[model samples]
Target: MSDKAYDDRNNLGGRVRRYARVGGSVGGLAARLAGDRLFGMKIDRDDHAMELAQALGNLKGPVMKVAQILSTIPDALPKEYAQELAQLQAAAPSMGWTFVKRRMRTELGEGWRDRFASFDREASAAASLGQVHKATDTAGHALAVKLQYPDMGAAVEADLNQLDWMLSLFRRYDKSVDTSQIREELAERLREELDYALEARHIALYRHMLADEPTVHVPAVYPDLSAGRLLTMEWLDGTPLMRFTDADQETRNTIARNLFRAWYVPFHRYGVIHGDPHLGNYAARDDLSINLLDFGCVRVFPPRFCGGVIDLYKALRDGDEALAVAAYEAWGFHNLSRELVETLNIWASFLYSPLMEDKPRLINPADNPGQYGAETATKVHKKLKELGPVTPPREFVFMDRAALGLGGVFLRLGATLNWHQLFHDIVGDFSVEALAARQNQALAAAGMEGTVDGR
Candidate 1:
């Protein structure tokens, strides 16, 4: 491997440093939980959960990202933990210019500054894994240069170990949702996010999937200036989606429609999804169009899984028990009992409720937009506990996450629309065979053939 590539991997020193940091921050919670479990001592879960969130929040990398993801999934973590972790943002403090200069030099050599007409010393934005710097290319075009933080491979490995321990501890206390598959799925995606070259391909794949989508924008990547740890792409000018939350109803609805198309059209047609639907991942233009950012957490699904999503929706809508069973089976759920199916349906119906109604309505009529799915999630969690453990298909992790994430966004916007018709407009003629064919064409066109199991 190249020296530059070696620098990104989990070196001995980096791994040690990461472990020390994570363990130092969270070791107290681990000891406390262990005491509670072994000695039958009672501890204030809410307070401990907050302490754990604060601990992870202070750390950088996939641990924080994993915490945020777990917070959204129902029963993945205890309610108190989820509530506190949900407050953790995808962002972190930016690295200094000295660090940025060294990173740029590592990515593009010592003369890296000459490639740009002008590059900002300060990062325009920062996130868990990387930070974005605004710059002007030699030809005077605007660009966003995303530089991956150093030793992320070590960080990811360390954080994933911590994640497994945390989940295992939770499992010892509660057996509602089996998190083994969730850990594996998150590990694969988190590792993938460390590779900017793979992310560049994801960007290409998204561009191919949404080429005809005029209302949604995907930035064009600059191959010459990009590297495994660095990505340079066309700069998209837009405002944060949250900024429009207080806008007029019509404006909010238009933005909502565009956001819906941007997220679903790719999944419905190409069998791929942008799994991280965090508000910061997208921005809205004055024209109401959205700029979809951060290609790292994308999921390219098997064609059958895509069909299964639609099948389950129809099964719930038409009250077909057998079809629901088949749909769940298609999604990799097996040996499901009648009671389990009924239990699963409670959550399914809640998700499909918005899509079932033909008239315009709010995504959730709840007064507190932030608590949109909390109650339903709690109900489902209770049922799952009674039904025993269910190992959710790995694919279901992000699919459910995206749904909940978008639902929260819609609730925040207070956008009203005929969701049933909007959903029908995309899946009116849905077929697994056609979807597979389209997915293959798009993947091939984007030079991502075999990178994902299109079948």
Candidate 2:
């Protein structure tokens, strides 16, 4: 079907139905909050947060995913709300076999069943936006077929409107962070995720970027069996990363090291990152190699932004205030007051601290991995509140998310390594020009030319 056909399907009626369905829950919550404010009634924030989570949980879609993302970002939402929403899982109730059959017919053709040697009636895995089924191709290769939920375009538009309202409500109550850019960034990435064709390109991009890294694996996409709302790929067999926590220290460390390479190598080498590091997004083989999955939430950064990341690390390590300011400027931060810079450095130093140390050590020996950056985030949020609201550059959203998410994983595995050496191994010879060239070549090779900054 053409893009216009898809758009026509998700017309005004679809959007209105979605809004009514989602708003029934979220709108009620909004009303309650507004009532509390108007009546000057004391609110039990924790209770309301729980109610909010329950509401979003029941209506799984982009809003629920946004809640999960917000929970990880410090001060993105109230502490109570973040804690409650953090418990929101990616798994949602899967569409029934009847719906799957119809969707397959729509995406492929009436003879879709003939293309597959066999296809499971049940979903192998289900998430907010889509569900995956185990299948075998005509060539007898094991494949994972991802089918997007119906009306997702309409669902995304409605959810984004609801998200904007929720953020606005929070802003009215607290002004620690200006979430306007954050919303825009999330909306863009979420919209991109709806296109499985783009995700196919992302898979190619990762395969090319990590081709030299034997420890990391990227799945091969089957274009013939895929569509805008459906993706077919080589199915990888592995154990979830969380299951390896109790394994021998060596095994655990190996997994952690491989995971670190899987995530960071692409970022440092090509100015790209797997934005979402949720545990479910990857797994580990018996040989300790990593299988990176879910290419939906990928971010491509400008070469200069990648350079700024390294510059900020060095600035913090060497106490170079001048270079630090320049790095912030490169990252799109404007009008950085001495106080604001100092405040921002607090969070940056915390993230970069694990990498600055020269000796082998756990990522954060002092704190529980679950509460990895909560304390520091609270401190930073307090300072920002006092300093007035600051709009973090959109790129900061996933960059920070990747750091904190991976840090939590490293802490969980108790991976002891000279992080400084590991980091230097990648960026020791880094240059903006070199990175730009490599990024362009890799992107073009993957059919993603001119996507980021128009090259």
Candidate 3:
């Protein structure tokens, strides 16, 4: 093997084993403790869950990021697991100056210092696979330099394998949700996220799509300084999305409006969805506009698929089971049997409830189904248990993650608005022929196969 590949493999192998060992041990302990003296009690469960979360957080890799994502999706984990995994969303500890210097030297070579006017030795934010540093360009523009942690690609793959093992253990512990489909989807999304080049492209596409939308802001990427492993963009300042929760109702509504646009504009207009809708991926600006961050988990759909979503919503609103089934088939769920379709509709109806209603729908913190956030998720899991393994269509994966993830954020915000109105405005001009034309145009523009015409 080449020297570079050898180094990547060896370094990653060490981190993976460390994480698996730590996670496995914690899972075992938590299982035993739950079974013994403190099973099901709130405090005991909380303590046990928190201990596992901290262990994974300290590991600070794909394992931690996966845990954080799973935490947001109800029924993906128990209440305590979800609560504990929430802690992983906080800023990770940054690497020391010595390590940062080494990374720079490795990626930019020894003369990298001459390329920038100034580069901060310290990181502003440390995430799962990388950290962001504030830097100044020679042209006098402020920039955010995203430096990938060394050997992270391999580490991510390794961590995913370990996560698979942990999830199996989880399934045995709690058979509420069949997480295999979820895990596979997450693995693909996370792998794409690790590729910074893909992230740069996603960011650029979003910038172009959101240009006319004033309330939503996506950073302008500096392509000259970006590489497969590194990304640099204009630095943006904003508060976390959570801060808006305590603001006045009007202010909160304004923020939510921008958020609604920020999320749906791309999906409806361009067939691309920002797959990771965690609170950390968005920021609340002082001007009431929202700042969109992290393009790692973006999903691109065909225009036809986008239309399929609308068709399904309309079908559910009108109680047209035939049309609804057709929409699901269009979405690639060929195995959606009659009984399964009914159960699936229970969930789809809930998701489309906000848009189906004339007035605003309030999703208060108290109204939260809590651990059973998605009734369909529970029903589907039960069905899967009875019927055996169901091969989920690939296209369904990322969109589901994005939908649930975004819904979780809205739940946290507790901001109510006329969701149906905004949704309608996005796809007001929807047409099958027009959608097909646009889908082909986008595919040709991106130099990708044009087969994704909502098949």
* TM-score of every candidate: 0.97, 0.96, 0.86
The C-alpha stretches of model 1 lying farther than 4 A from their native spots are 1-6
Candidate 3 Cα outliers beyond 4 Å, as residue runs: 1-12, 15-27, 30-48, 72-80, 170-179, 363-392, 439-455
In TM-score terms, candidate 2 sits at 0.96
Model 1 agreement with the true structure over 1-455: per-residue lDDT tens digits? 34453376888777888889998999779778767876788899889989999999988788899998998888898787788888888889998887788888888999999999999999999999999999999999999999998889999998889888888888888888899989898999999999899899899988988899899999999999999899999999999998989999999999999999999999998888998886788899989899998999989899999989999999998999999999998888878999999988988999999999999999878787656678888998999889889999898888988888888889889899989989999999999999999999988888888866525
State model 2's lDDT: 0.87
- What does candidate 2's lDDT look like per residue over 113-158, in tens digits? 9999999999988999999999999999999999998788888888
Better of 2 and 3 by TM-score: 2
Residue 319 error, candidate 2, Å: 0.4
Maximum-lDDT candidate: 1
Instruction: Show model 2 residue runs off by greater than 4 Å.
Output: 1-9, 35-39, 366-368
CA lDDT of each prediction against the hidden true structure? 0.89, 0.87, 0.73
Better of 1 and 2 by lDDT: 1
Candidate 3 lDDT over 1-455, as tens digits, reads: 23253233336466666566655656675555446444553446677787878778777667787887777554566666776676566467887777766666666677877879999988988887789999988998889999876667677777777777767766765564567777887888888877787787677677777889989898988878776677999888899887777778778778888898999887877777887777788898889898987888777776657767888998998888888888887777766777777866766776777787776765433355233254456565576556654455667767765776777777767778888888888889977676566555654554444534444
